[model samples]
Target: MARRARGTSAGLDRHRIATAAVALVDRDGLERFGVRRLADELGVDPMSIYHHVKGKAALLDAASEAVLHEVEIGAAEASDDWAEIARRTAHGYRAVACRHPRVFPLVVVRARTSPVTVAAVERLVTAMRAAGLPDRVVADTPGVLFGFLNGHLLARTGEGPEVPAPVGEFDAAAHPTTAALAPLLSDVGSVAEFDRLLDTVLAGIRVSAASG
Candidate 1:
């Protein structure tokens, strides 16, 4: 075993500190993560982490990058089907979000300068360009696509629009129509839903790009 640093718990370095920080957030969540907690996990002093990372924010940036690296886009396919490319990109992003629901928000809120994130964005932009979308649409598509993805992911995590309340619980006397349509209003989010949504968005983009 690596011996502890003198007057400290164990050997420390940027890689080790960052790895521990990512693990802390993965296990406990971002809100519970902190340098002191990370130090405790590493059996070191709280200040020891500052030497490796600037502060919690910098540490979070590292953690976000770490989590994003798990998303694998693989080699680009040798085709110009932008719809397929967009689908792959969307699925890759959703996989990462589903894997780390808590850490997902970090990638969303923090500045995304990670190599993987950059590559992912580049891949999407390339696809949009290949599709012959207008320059403005090419630039704006990412925001719209990601917004839909984030919304869907949030719903998966129970933080987005909620399913309709049970029909039995509704005031049937005052709202007969709502009670009658309760079964139809019950909503479920699933992989099928995500696939359909991606397909629809891509189709709409194609139509919009063609019309302009």
Candidate 2:
């Protein structure tokens, strides 16, 4: 491919810049991502990036938005089942996180208030509402669902130590349950565990909607 001019990102616009930024972050991670690096990848000077994206923070936000754009939330005509909609939406979010494990933390921690994020939230809320969920329950359900997914993804990414403390060494005499479960703790946080948890969550939402 012919190199883009050094001082001019000729054909690049905001979307193209954001797209490249996402690829760069996926490759290099947020810790090492910078305008200079992005410029280098694009075959342009660092200042040329500012012509498309505002700066580092805005660029990161754009990249995060790009990551979220990959999620396939589907349209209303596709499915009327609220549980299925929620399940698919949750998986879409999880898929992005899983693909970019290093970049996933950045997605989780940052305030995703972009238009794309807002549209996604609306889709989830709309699904719950279409399922005849109570107005208030519908309003809060998206946060409840995505919050669980984000928390779980963060844990899966090893945000903390595999074993935080030495619970295994604790006396089984005083805390038999804790000591006994310690052995199993290491095996937790699997896809099966996530499925079980999501099932429990959807069940609770159904009950709440039914009761309301």
Candidate 3:
């Protein structure tokens, strides 16, 4: 080994730090994650992490980026069918959330824009444009599509990967409609529920395309 520098942190890189940070957050969740905690997890001093990632906020961004990488877009994203691309992208996003329920929130709520995010959006619009959707529809596709995914996945992931406890019985006399729909509402995070609603969202997009 060569002579050491005056005072540099050793045996740590940005990727290693990011991977470890993601694991810590996955195990303990964002509320409890901290630079010191991550450093302890990595078996290093806190300053060593700072050397790689700058600080905690940056660390969170790094961790979020690392988790986002697990999303597998596959060949469907490259297909000519815009709706197919959208469905595949949605599945990938949900897969990431399911894999790391605690870390998924950071991927959305963070103010920073990630390249992975931007690329996914690009794929959506490119496929939409290729499908002959009008300009107005293509421009709005990402927000409208992601709104549904984010709202549903956040609730689903928080509920974890179990058969969610049913919404139980609701009185029909006082609030008939609410009572009747209660079971469906409580079925928040099921795979079947996600696919069913995602198809509805696709129908709406198709209407927009047809009208345009």
Candidate 4:
């Protein structure tokens, strides 16, 4: 527990402010988040929050940082095989996104220049370069991999059901292939589905590596 500071500053610090801000956004969401609202949430003056985090943009970034710290992502060991490390990093990143679907958007859209974000990217890129990936492939991999992960996760973890309702059988006369694959089409967002798609992405990277 943070001991309430004696007087002038409302006892607020960056960490406490960050924790409260993230909680506020997690509950009511970004549309309702603001310094005054956060101050009300924290039982402090708006100035107190400003004293710590400066502005709404900075506070949002802080909240994103706090959420990222919850998972062990991009910890690609130097000596580990690059593909294995990539798999591990992908899974960890997925875990965090699954854990915080609302905040996950910030991770995707924000220009996160924090130490945690930097370090994670550094480790993963180092492992990739060590694996002898061509310069272009090495530079392209993170954006490509993360773009896939982000799009897939946003679809799966966003509002509504995890799996879509079955389309049932289509008219075979009009849509033979659609009728045949309707069952598989409805079975979406499973762990197996996520893994298989991730493998597909990795396979493409492998091809890129081979041709590079």
Candidate 5:
């Protein structure tokens, strides 16, 4: 059994606690996570977590911030096109979420005020503004993009229902359309598929903005 480490003042900081919490979530499902458990993992008391985070919700937010900070927006900016930047950002987030499915919900709902998240949003807003999007659009684009990325990742990981396997009998009978679409659905797991969809969405957004 792993025992909590001794020494109250072990130089354990809030960032370290939050990082440990994120690691805990990555290893175990969020439903199994608690401050006490995380403290145990960190070899500290539950109260130690409070010294870093206010409560469960705050810990979750910090966990999410930690995950988002893992994204390398600077490295993803190989292309100068705003649409490309957005697509790369989406892909980066999707990759992170896929790597940490237990933390997906936290990523979607964590408060936007965390410094890492705020910096990400600022970077995104600046990109959108440079792309000729209006100030309001720039402000709202992060939410829109984040929602899309979250929904896409959730759908891809089979996080919900296992789409019933294609049935040859049912397919030959009344559900020809769905049967035909089954193969298409099967191909949707590739990164290429996501990139294509992202391109299409960004194109539509560009058109809508130009028209409006």
Candidate 6:
């Protein structure tokens, strides 16, 4: 319910505008959001937003950063196992995206050069370094981990139709393997399955490093 200044516009800041925009997106679907809508939400004229942001694209970038910033990586205290920490961090991101499916795509595609995003990446890198990962590995792991998490969440959320509708009960007569695995795929609550896959991936990374 916080409203922008009515008479005075001089107090408006970019952060405040970005925060309002994010709130607007959260309340309404991204497709329904626009500068004018955001301006109305902030109790300011649409032109006032232009003073702080170049346009909608700029505002979208800011909105993406605002959502990403909402992800809390938690205390830096070491876990008993570094791999578990990585898994937990990945799950944390997945959970956030799941809670905000409409906002997740923007976060995934936003420019990585933004200061807020850079800070978050740096924190992850620092944590990886502390967990005994080499600098090169630390630098690359976050990108890979995030990519997987984003893809997994987007797929899980049914953002797009991945599987075609069965003409009639999957037709096991034509394809044996797919039909055999159909039951497994139908299990919607697969968080445990995803966690197991995550551990496998982490183990593979460790093995690859040892081999090299």
Model 5 ranges off by over 4 Å: 1-8, 76-78, 131-140, 158-175
Please give the TM-score that candidate 1 achieves against the real structure: 0.79
Candidate 4 lDDT, tens digit per residue, 65-114?
Answer: 88888768544574467778777777887888787777778777774566
What is the per-residue lDDT of model 6 for residues 164-196, given as tens digits with 9 covering 90 to 100? 222226568788887777776554436776786
What is candidate 6's local distance difference test score?
0.71
List residue ranges in candidate 2 displaced over 4 A: 1-10, 74-76, 158-176, 182-189
Pairs that collide in candidate 4 are none
On TM-score, the candidate that comes out on top is 3
lDDT of 5 by residue, 125-177 (tens): 77778778877666667777767776777666535545423232363457777
Superposed model 6: Cα runs more than 4 Å off: 1-7, 113-139, 158-173, 186-190
- lDDT tens digits, residues 1-212, model 1? 24365675456787777677777877887778878788889877788778778988888888777777777764446546767777877888888787777777877777456677677778778877876789877887777787777766755643333442333365788998887776654454556767877889878777778887
TM-score of each: 0.79, 0.79, 0.86, 0.80, 0.79, 0.76
- Candidates' lDDT values, in order? 0.73, 0.75, 0.80, 0.76, 0.73, 0.71
Candidate 5's TM-score: 0.79
The C-alpha stretches of model 1 lying farther than 4 A from their native spots are 1-9, 158-187
Name the weakest run of 10 consecutive residues (lDDT summed) in model 2: 159-168
Residue 167 Cα positional deviation in candidate 4, in Å, after optimal superposition: 10
Worst 10 residues of 3 by lDDT: 159-168
Best by lDDT: 3
The sequence of per-residue lDDT tens digits that candidate 2 reaches over residues 113-158 is 7565687777777877876789988877877887888877877764
